[model samples]
Target: MEKYTPLRTATLKPKSIYYPLHIRKLIKHKKKLFKEFKNSNFGLDEYIKVSKTIKHLINSYKSQKIKSIVSNTNRIYKYMKNISQKYSPIPCLENDNIFIFDDKTKCNLFASVFARSFSNLPTFDPPELTPCKFMHALDDIEFNLLDIDNILKNLPNNNCCAEDGISYTLLKACHSSITPFLSDIFRLSLDTGIIPQSRKVSYITPVFKKGDKNNAENYRPISITSTICRVLERIILNSLLIHLEENNIISQNQFGFLKKRSTTTQLIFTFSHWYKAVLESKNIDCAYIDLKHAFDSVPVRFLLYKLFNIGIRGKLLNWISSFLTDRTAKVKINNTFSNSFQIHSGVPKDPYWDPSYF
Candidate 1:
């Protein structure tokens, strides 16, 4: 058998498991007291009063300690110098919409860097759904079939059935027609403005000085949470347009107009109206899925397909792919050593500009 020897100077300490013996004993005593109190013929009012008193005492002690700590560290002068130095230079713009930073002729140099980074993301793609396959799935779930005749009848009076019909020809030729079914669903929502009420409030406007540019330093920066919500609104509108266009539900010209019309403000107002109706109905079992890190993990192939579907053709696609190659950045611990770092870059989150391009 091998002999075990302890080290003269210990390099590693054994992990210690601590048992809260005192706390356990106190808890046991409290349980015994509670049992005794329950067994006794003590008045309910007295028991309630005693419980309230104990809670109040504990809370008062905690509040006193917290206040003391807060008072000791609340020196305003120490933070003044730091705050004064942290002020950002005010931004100004010149004629021709060019930004001039710090009175220099150069535009905000960081803007270009940020734009290049944004443009280098993998092209976007919507998931494909064949009309027949979609219909079959819906049928399996017993979804209500939309009124196609009513939809066709509501088409603009000036719509040329012969010429405009070609837009939907590709969809008709497909082995499974998914776009028409999607179009029906879209039309139903458009007519009713069906907004799900469960979506959490993602943004709020920050209070800032009205038209007083000098007081910029006094206001908190615009909330990033609000910006993200606006982006989500844009993404939804863009997705709807993309779905319509891909399914041949609308002409390219019609798609362009719809894209321009769908705005974040409009969507929010529409959703607000929808939720009001939902509340009136008193139905409350709705749920919302908060997708974390949605953009970074978007498959490259899916993005390529979306681009292709939206008519991002030929050289544009190739150029975008090439741009993404060198645009990535790496985090390094040692500035000189390239190997001692991990590489990463910001992937395109659902952009606020999504509706405009779609």
Candidate 2:
């Protein structure tokens, strides 16, 4: 019996910055008064007075903290996250008339729903196009130690780690020791069209979208891949953009991923055209089209075909093909994780990869 040890458990309680020691002591005293009131009906009035005083102090402290945080631009988001750290466990999920209460089962249900959201219809063959004449072929791009170090330095320090359990903080801290090795690996991957298997596996968390929380379809999967994988992606993206810009492969009208162009610029350009049409006394006709799951539903084969037509061929294209294929992920709900499953289609929902693919 002495050799057996009990499993220790701890509840997560985020400390509030605005909470004062005096108020906490007062609340403890209030609990003591409440106990006396319940036993002998002696301290009811004192308990009420203490409760009101604690409430007033809390409001005052919260207001002061908000004012200080608002005065500084950098701390607003951090403060918001701290106050909004309340955890609400997901309720039981219903799938096919069966209710699932187990966390692992719930995670599996979400995985199945998210898997079906990918566009898995037959691939459409692209029409034949005239071969692009390039000044030079973009067969491969090499990375140096400086490039790796610079990318690591620019990475966000607050990002969560992926399934690989490698965090940005860890990479940035030990980059001097690992950059040379990473550079060699990147060069080899580009040259041989062989990417690491760990790079292709993502960790998914389901975030609530809208409607019934009990329904599995009401959540969207946010996929997180390895930190090292993203670094390689950045290197490839930079080279790809340079080739596209040099060859005039991408049109100016396509304003999503290019430099100095965004949704705001596109809106401004459209409104300017509308104002000119109004001045000319011309009739205006417009149609708005919004594609659902635009990022997740794109066929990988079709995307590869488009890239090939745009002069992204040879070893570079093969490397991209290898990166996109044979992807897998495990869905996590609370502390439970579902078994690993293969992802059939769609580019990763990461900020760096999604826009470039589009």
Candidate 3:
């Protein structure tokens, strides 16, 4: 009997091996043709035909893995939906009072209060203090007072005027300005003609010096942005409450007072307490309407009306209008200055001195 060798070791293999050999020969023949065509001056039409054939062959050989994945995914989703229907959660009709919700999950409007009570909060760095630090400190202390004076000075003859104390006067002026607007919305006498007392009844005198590290007692304190934020928040909340009461959403009995605190922590804690009280008492449907560009998009006519309702008149209104008309923003480093265009919408992260101006 003749010894038989494996097909791989045989000089001449079976048709199965010859099949692959034939395929390789065909591939080599095509490559040779392509090389010849490249070497010769083939017309654009011939070149295109060859390219299309190559692309077609390559595409035909490519795996359909993506298609398979997509099909599997569709099947999985269908199965999941069936399972979900069998174990679906009960629909909740009563909304959560603590969190405001819109068409999407997020609320459209919310108020923030600014107050920094603790002396240990980080101080403004050297660059920030390089400007008139003394003036800045003084200005911060006198913000509410200054705003009241301005409102009084701009009061229209038709509107009520502030009488004596800064807070008292501003409250009166604010009520006069805001009442008509509220009345228009509610078709009632929404104007209280009184300002709510400042939640912050006292101010902690700010420490000025950049204290030395060695003198542990003398180190400067952190500038509390929270304090100012809280103040603005209180103003917003009070205004809203007054409007709501006028609209009959709440009654005088439902109304409550919140004492103002000088420190950031106190302000936050008090606000949290007030928040809990409101949540417990009422079925509040809070809506936070965030306009695309609040400051920039504020139409001149509409803003004027709002200002007028707040008792702003004549030159002050004109001044505000003019100030907003041609807006320009810039940042300076060392001595060089570069100007930039200001956006019309979106809330700024850090609270500026007059955020309304933005």
Candidate 4:
């Protein structure tokens, strides 16, 4: 029996079984007290007490959520690292005639290919989309301090951080110090006609697209930059969308990136439109246009001209043009790093900014 080292069997139990009933009742009672405090005309002392209690309760809830978020992000990061190990940088075409695997060679090759593809004409002419007349004055647009809070609130606490390693969690932790600085940057961009330097740098990831693995053309470039820049971009995007909405400028046929709109909405709308056409016995045809790397292929000079025509004039126009210029990126694959290269084209992909840019 001593040699056997007898062990008792353990039974698994649900988490709910472990929660003490007394603690549960106390929690319920506190919640009731919180509701009563909010509803009643209490004295200052009572109000302060209740407010502290409420804040304590909220903080406890948030702390639990933070734990879950950190755990999940850790898991996700590990999974990504594991998956990334399966695919390392390979020998890609140096030109149509040659192939090379060195990180520097690959980096330069990718940069040159995209730069050539997206190069603007020698002259930076105004874009074609500039409207004939002003629908709304740019200066008349108002920016509220509360909009800054809203932007911060919506930021995903766990997301791709830029070169600075400033995660949303870090930003949120230092929001008091960060907010004022960011606000000033936003105002200064609007005031001085120069966008911040952070907005111009992107960390490029060469995600594989459908094609020959050795061909650089097969990879689609995705940009991840500073969350701070993303926030500023969001502010600008919101302004742009408002201007477009006020002017009724967006086409009904287009359903990408607007509030409460998606590719699914467009698909449904198209099906209905075609179904009605079929029911009415009307002969019709439709064409689908899919430009490979459509977003990256657009020339910045031409896009600026389009925005100019659309009533984004003066400093606002200049800021947008400046935002698009002198942009750069560095590629990463496990530990092998590529040299920073100039990105001459492709609107940087921020979910908030890309659709509006087009």
Best by lDDT: 2
What pairs collide in candidate 4? 126-305, 127-305, 127-306, 128-306, 129-306, 130-309, 130-310, 131-309, 131-310
Residues 297-351, candidate 2: write the lDDT tens digits. 7778878887887778789999999998898888987668888888777887668
Q: Which ranges in model 2 have alpha carbons more than 4 Å from their true place?
A: 1-85, 129-134
Best by TM-score: 2
| Residue 212, candidate 4: C-alpha displacement in angstroms | 3.5
Task: Arrange candidates, best lDDT first.
Answer: 2, 4, 1, 3
List model 3 lDDT by residue over 13-90, tens digit each: 222212234445555666766677778855556556656665565454333433444568676675455435442211
By TM-score, how accurate is candidate 2? 0.78
Q: How accurate is candidate 1 locally (lDDT)?
A: 0.36
Which segments of model 3 are wrong by more than 4 Å? 1-301, 333-335, 339-358
- The candidate 1 region of ten consecutive residues with least summed lDDT is 133-142
Per-model TM-score on C-alpha atoms: 0.26, 0.78, 0.21, 0.66
278 Cα displacement, candidate 4 (Å):
2.5
CA lDDT scores, all candidates in order: 0.36, 0.83, 0.34, 0.69
lDDT-best of 1 and 2: 2
Error of 4 at 119 (Å): 2.4
**lDDT, candidate 4, 1-358, per-residue tens:** 3578687866643223223454455566666766766778445565566556655766676466456657686666754564355544555554667868677677766655555555544455543443545566564244566777777766776645667667777666666566777787777877777765766777776777777878888776777787776777778778877887787777787788788888889889989989999999997798889886667766787777677666777777777788888887776553444667676666888776775676
Clashes of each: 4, 0, 24, 9
Candidate 4's clash total is 9
Candidate 1 per-residue C-alpha lDDT over 1-358 given as tens digits, one digit per residue, 9 for 90 to 100: 1268554643543333232565345445555666767898555565565566555655665466456556544544433343344434444534345444442222223223223333433454455743221111100011122433233333232211111122222323331344356445444433343422221111111233346433322222121112212222332444444554565555433322354444555566657867997989855464547643333334445554555554444443443333223322211111111111111223222234322333
